[model samples]
Every structure is written in C-alpha cells, then in structure tokens.
Target: MSAQLDRESSENLLSDSRFFFEKIWLNVSLYLAFKIRSVNAPFWVEDTMASSLKPL
Candidate 1:
C-alpha cells in the first residue's frame, strides 16, 4: 500500500514537471511571435501605404 502510494506520488511529480515545462515553452513561443509581429508591423504599414499610392 505504501509502495503504491509512493509510485503514484512520483508519477504525479513527473507529470507536473512536464506540464510546467510545456507551459514555459508555450509562453516563450507566444512572446517571441508577438515580438516578431510588432517588429514587422511598421514595415507592413509602409508597404500598404506605398501600394495605395501607386497609380491604378
């Protein structure tokens, strides 16, 4: 009984650690994507403006 409980506890700890690492990775990826989008926003706006100014 105690051995089973210990095994269960260890499994839970491993699962929790995996979940924590996955969450951290997701957050970092989202942050990097946001940063890239922000950096490109100005260039996109400029391109749109130039396209709109072109004679149709």
Candidate 2:
C-alpha cells in the first residue's frame, strides 16, 4: 500500500510539472510572436506603401 501511494504521488508530481512547463512554453511563444510582429510592422507598412505608390 505504501509503495502504491508513492507511485501515485510521483505521477501527480510529474503531471503538475508538465502542465507548468506547457503553460510557460505557451506564454513564451506568444511573447516572441508578438515581439516579432511589432518589430516587423513598420517595415510591412512601408513595403505596402511603396508598392502602392510605384508606377506601373
């Protein structure tokens, strides 16, 4: 019985850690994506404007 409890506790701990890591990874990915978009936004606008203004 004691061994069973220990196994269950360890499994719970592993699951909790996995959930924590997944949350952190998601937050980091979102942050990086937002940063990239913000960094590229101005260049995107300039490119669009330049293309629109170009004479065909």
List runs of model 1 lying over 4 Å from the truth.
41-56
Error of model 2, residue 32, in angstroms = 0.1
lDDT of 1 by residue, 22-55 (tens): 8897677666656756676677765664464364
Q: Go through the candidates in order and give each one's C-alpha lDDT.
A: 0.73, 0.73
TM-score of each: 0.66, 0.69
TM-score of 1: 0.66
TM-score of 2: 0.69
